[model samples]
Target: MVNQAKAHIAIPMGDPAGIGPEITVKSLAKAEIYDVCKPVVVGHTEVMKKALAVTHTNLEINEISEPEEGKYEHGTIDMINLDNLNIDHLEWGVVQAQCGRAAFQYIKKSVELALEGKVAAIATTPINKESLKAGEVPYIGHTEMLEDLTNSRDPLTMFEVRNLRIFFLTRHVSLKDAISQMTKERVFEYIGRCEEALKRLGVENPLIAVAGLNPHSGENGLFGREEVDEIKPGIEMAVEKGYRAVGPVPADSVFYQALQGKYDAVLSLYHDQGHIAAKMTDFERTISITNGLPFLRTSVDHGTAFDIAGKNIASSVSMEECIKLAAKYAPNFRS
Candidate 1:
C-alpha cells in the first residue's frame, strides 16, 4: 500500500524537437496542478526554458538537482535536470539522434526514480519513433523501450480512459503484418493484462469486450477465421478463468457499446482499430496509461504536435488530465 503522503510525479520530456516541452510548461502553469501532487520534470533544463520562452508562459521554472529538492509551489515548475542534451543542434520538425538519445535518458531516469521510490508515478509526453530509432534505442515506442529496460516480454500497449479502456494487441504494424502477428496466446495474454489493469483501476468486477479483427467480426468466418480461431478462444478462456469477459464482437459495434458504458474496456486487434476509435470519439479529454509496468505511468493521449511545436498554440488539456490521473492513481502504486 502506498503511503498517503503527497506523491511526486516525474514527467519525462518527450522529443525535444516536438511540442513536449511547450505542453509541459503550459501544463505546469496551472496552479491547481500542484495542489494535488508534486510534479518534477525529468529532462533538459535548457530545453524546458526554450519551451517556456516559445510559449511565452509567464510561469517560473525551478531547476532542482534532484526530485526531493523540488519546491511544490503553485505557478512554479520544478524539474530534475538530466542535462543530457545540448539544445544548440536541435531542429524543429525533424528527427535527430541526439534528441532521441536524450529522450531515452529522461525516461531511464524517471524509471530509476520510481524503482527507488523517489516518486510515486511517472507521467510522460509522447516521443517520436523515428527519433528513437535514430538514437539506436532499438524499439518502436516507449512501451517497447520500457519493456526492454525492465526485461518484460509481455505484449503491452497504452491503455486510454477508464470507462472505455482500449488495448492494442498489435501496434505499429501494417494491417497485413498485424494479422500475421495475431496469435491465440498473444490474444489471451492481452486479455489477462486488461483484466488485471481494470481491477487496478478500481473496478472490482470489470467487463471486457474483445473486438473482432475483420469486418463484421469475420462475418462468421466469411471475412476471416481469426475471430473463431483466435479471439473467441481467448475470450472463452478468460471467461472460464472467472473474469467477466465477452466478445469477438464486431469491431464497429464494440466501441459503440464501450462508449455507451456497456463494457469496462475493449481489447482491439490492432493499432488503428482501437486508437482511431478512441481518439476520434474523444480526442482532447482522453488519457493514456501504460499498463504492465512496475509503476503507474500515464500521459497525454496526443503526440508532440511538431506542426504547432513553438507556437504556444498547443493545448494543455490532455497534459492536465494526465496529471490528474497520475495523482488519482498515485495512491495505488505499491511502494
Candidate 2:
C-alpha cells in the first residue's frame, strides 16, 4: 500500500489538437478517480479549459504551480502547467509542430515528476506521431521516446492488458523490416520480458504463448522458418530458465485461448498480429503498460482520434480505464 500523502500520479495531456485534453477533463470530473490517488495533469491549463468548453464538461480547473499545491479534490481538474505551448495557435484535427512540442513537454514533465518521487506513476494520453515529428521530436511512439529519455537498456515491452498481455517483437516497421529484426536474440529478450512482466502483474506461474511470424506458424517451415528457427528456439531458452513457456503457436488460435485464460500472455512476432487481437478482443478496456521502465507507466491503447477532435464525440472509456490501471499498479512499486 502507498502512503497517501506521498503518492501522486501525473497525467500528460497529449496533443492539444486531439481529444486528450477533453477526455482528461472528463476523467477528472468524476469523484471516484480521486478516491484512490491524487491525479495532477502536467500540461497547460488553457488547453484544458478549451477542452472543457468544447466537451461541455462541468470541471473546474485548478492551476497548480507545483505538485504540492495540487488540490487532489474530486470533481476538480488540477494542472501543473508547463507553460510551454500556447493553445491559441493549435488547430484541432490538424497536425502541427507546436502541438507536438507541447505533447513532448507534457511527457517530459511527467517523467521528471516520477523520477523525483513527486508522482508514483505516469499515465499518458495518445500523441500523434506526425505532430511529434513536426515538432522536431523524432520518436515513432511513446515506448521509444520513454526508453530514450530514461536511458534504459533493458528490452522495452508493451503489455496490452492484464490477463491477455501481448508484446510486439517489432513496432513501427514494415512487414519486411520486421522480418529482418526478428533474430533469435531479440526473440529471446521478448520472451524474458514477457516472463518478468507476468511476474510483476502478480502471476505466480505464467504460461507464455509465442506466435508464429508467417501463416499457420510457418506451416512447419513450409511458409517461413521463423517459427521453427528463431521463435521456437527463444521459447526453448525461456523454458530452460524455468518459465512455463511453449509456442510458435499459430497466431489465430493463440489469442482466443489467451482470452479464455489459457495463457498468461502472448508474444507476437510483429505488431499487428498482437494488436489486432487485443483491440478486437477489447479495445475500450485495453490498457498499454510499458515494461522495463524505472517507474510504472501506462497509456491508452488507442491513438489520437484526429477525425473526432473538437466534435465532442471521442470516447473517454479508454482514458478512464488507463487511469484505473495506473492506480491499480502504482501500489506495486511502493518500496
Candidate 3:
C-alpha cells in the first residue's frame, strides 16, 4: 500500500536523447524512494521502457492518466504517459528537435499537475539547451520555462548539499555583467528574499551570510570597493529590517564557514561563486531548488549527458538526492 502520508513527487523525464530517462528509472528502482514519497514519472512510457531495458531493471511500468490513479507503490513505477515520443525513430546520445519538444511537454504537464494540487512537488531531470533551441522552444532552460509558465519574476535559486545552503544573487549572466549587477539595493533585496526562502524550507530565524565579490572582500577597498561600498551596506539594511543577515564575508572563507554550520545560508554574489563551493563539496549530492515559486521544485544539479545516454552508465545519485530533498522540504513548502 502507498503511504498516504508521503508526498507525491512528480518526476519529469528530461531530454529523451539524454540520460534523463535512464537516471529516472534507476533512481526509482531504489526501495528507499518508496519509503519517503510516491513518485510518478510525467513522461513517455516507451522511453521509460527502453531505459529499463538498458539498465536491466526488473521494475514494471504502471501507466496512468492522472496522479490520483497511480498505485504509488514500490516494484511498480507509476508513469503519467504523455505518449509524445516515437521511440523507434528516437536516437540516443544526440540532439533531436523531437526529443526537445517532448521534454518541454513533460515539464508542462508536471507544472500543470502541481498547480492543480494533484502533486505535492516536482523533482526534475535535466534538459538540453541545444535541443530546446533546435525544437524552437521559447525558453532556454528549466528556470526560464518555469518562470514564464508560472508567471514568476526573478525566481530565487538555492543549492543544498550536506546541510550547507548557498543562494545566488545573480545567475546565467556574464561575469562582467554579474559584477555590474551587484549593488547595495540588489544585495539588500536578495538577502531579504533568501531569508524568506530559508524560512519556507523550515529554517527559523535564518542567519544569512553575504559572500564578498573580490579578493579578501576588497581588502578594505584595496582590490575593489564592492564589499565596502555595496555588500556591507546591503547587509546592514537587511539587519535593520529585522532580518538576521551578516557579512560581506570574504568569498574565500564564507562558503567554508557556512559548510561548518556557521550560518543557515550563504548569499552568493554570482553564479560560480556558490556553485563551485557546493559542487566541490559533493557533486552528485548537490540538489538545486527553485525558490519563490508557487510550488516546490527541485532538480538534479547536473546537465543532460548526451554522450552517455543509453549506455546505462549515468549515475542516479543526483536524481535520488533531488527527490529526497523535495520530499524532505515538501511538508513546510507553502502552496
Best by lDDT: 3
Q: Is candidate 2 or candidate 3 better by lDDT?
A: 3
Off by over 4 Å in 3: 1-3
lDDT for model 3, please: 0.91
lDDT of 1: 0.82
TM-score per prediction, in order, is: 0.92, 0.93, 0.98
Tens digits of per-residue lDDT for model 3, 175-247: 9999888889999999999988998888999999999888888989999988888889988988899999988
lDDT of 2 by residue, 266-334 (tens): 888777888888888888878888878878898988788999988889888888888888888787766
Clashes per candidate (backbone, < 3 Å):
0, 0, 0
Looking at model 1, the pairs that clash are none
**What are the per-residue Cα lDDT tens digits for candidate 1 across 41-146?**
9998888889888888777778887778878898788988877776788777678999888888899998888877888888889898888889997777777777
Q: Predictions ranked by TM-score, top down?
A: 3, 2, 1
What is the Å distance of residue 230 in model 1 from its true position? 2.6
**lDDT minimum window of 10 residues, candidate 2:** 154-163
Choose the strongest candidate by TM-score.
3
Alpha-carbon runs more than 4 Å astray in model 2: 5-7
Predicted structure 3, TM vs. truth: 0.98
